[model samples]
Target: MPTLPISLVIITYNEAGHIARCLDSVPFAAEKIVVDSGSTDDTVAIATRHGAKVVQQPWLGFGPQRNFATTQATHDWILVLDADEYLSPELAAELERRLPTVMAGAAAVGILRRSTYYMGAPMRWYRPMVGERMARLYHRGRARWADVRVHESLRWEGSTVDFAAPFHHLHNPTLVHKQLKVLRYAELKCRDWLEKGKPVRMWQLPLVFIAAFLKDYLLRLAFLDGWRGFAVAHTAATYAAYKRLRYFEMRRNPDSVALAQAELIRYRLER
Candidate 1:
């Protein structure tokens, strides 16, 4: 049989609940590489059991870890994935069939990401105004992950292809877990603003919140998802509120700057 030429790479940190399924969804890739950030759980075992090569490393932020995983892959065409994300069957098939021809010189491919959680519930309102679509497949030596601490993505060195088949991101379900994600993401942005000594305005917070809500709820058609859309919009509002409130707290307690810096340090350490 002709060999597959693309590799699927993922960076993980204690993603035991969803790693197996994510790896299982893209068996056609030439290789599956898992770079685990010292997962205490059976995440490493799980990846290996599913025929993926597992490498261990300390957390080093999102992009760096992904780049680290790329080192272990032998193939020229690479597909980067998250432990909680998977390939939709239709899209996977399409990629499998088109990649080699596309990979001949294609710089990168942007695949749609249709995310769900809480039992496949689509949280339309909470999703990003511009949802994330990772540049997964790209020729080796031509693509690399950026160095951003969060939401880092691949830097494709050539032209791009946009696929209609959406990747699936199964986010954590519990309300508390979801809120924590909001808090983590918000806290990061708040700290980013504080370090830069960005000025805060009384009206700006509410405006930003409203803008995010309108973009996601009204513009993104969150209404189509029913309750999920409402939940997402509400969560987005909560995140905006958290960012502003945290910003206020930092300004009021100048000493908290040290605390925020420490949290960022810990986050980078755990990445």
Candidate 2:
């Protein structure tokens, strides 16, 4: 089958372990661009070997990094993917068959993502409140990622369509790995809030944790996935709590904020 006139844009830092699978999954892309921050590993070499045009860039937060990658694409239609994410066979086929027709009237294509946990089976429900629909494929002119430090998303106007398939997300497969990521993400979110001059909400910690847990476990139907679902909800609640706790800590002990900032810089370099 001939490839589509689309460019695959990915941002990476020390992603050698997963880059190959990510690059191989998108065989339909006419071109692939990898905007990599300094990687101590062989991430750049592996991407280059896989026929991707690799651009060296410094870490610029999650949202900014993705936006910068979109600008490097040769094609107007872009597919933004994470190093741990790839298209499932059904989704790949659906994308090739439907994208041309969808693009005629839609600004972006929202694909459902099926994510796994701790090397276990993929969860049937993961954060349903937020919706599993991810706007990954889009015209760069109409969509761009929000300039946030952590949880970033593409914002766009006009009509949008959904692909009736699920993209595979092989997320952190171990508890240790997941915990480290949670810490990093929570810190980043706290930093963003601090930068925005948001006040510390110490009193809301318990309420936030309870609300987040119930939202994921009950409202999101995470219970359907069994223990894995419970773990997911529990972890998510912990994250919500931690972000607030970090803010509270930073406000009480200003020196801790500097330590976290240094840790974040180290994480950016090594992550």
lDDT for each candidate structure = 0.74, 0.82
What lDDT does model 1 reach? 0.74
Error of 1 at 103 (Å): 1.2
Which run of 10 residues does model 1 get worst, by summed lDDT? 122-131
Q: Residue-wise lDDT of candidate 1 within 109-188, one digit each (tens)? A: 54555655543564544445225555676665777887645667677666787777777877666777787677666666
Show where candidate 2 strays beyond 4 Å: 115-118, 125-131, 264-271
TM-score, per-candidate, Cα-based? 0.83, 0.92
Pairs that clash in candidate 1:
59-271, 60-271, 76-140, 126-232
TM-score of 1: 0.83
Per-residue alpha-carbon lDDT of model 2 for 63-154, expressed as tens digits?
99899898899888898889988888888898889877766765564555554533555665556522367788888888889998789988
> With candidate 2 superimposed using the best TM-score fit, by how many Å does residue 58's alpha carbon deviate from the native?
0.5
- The TM-score of candidate 2 is 0.92
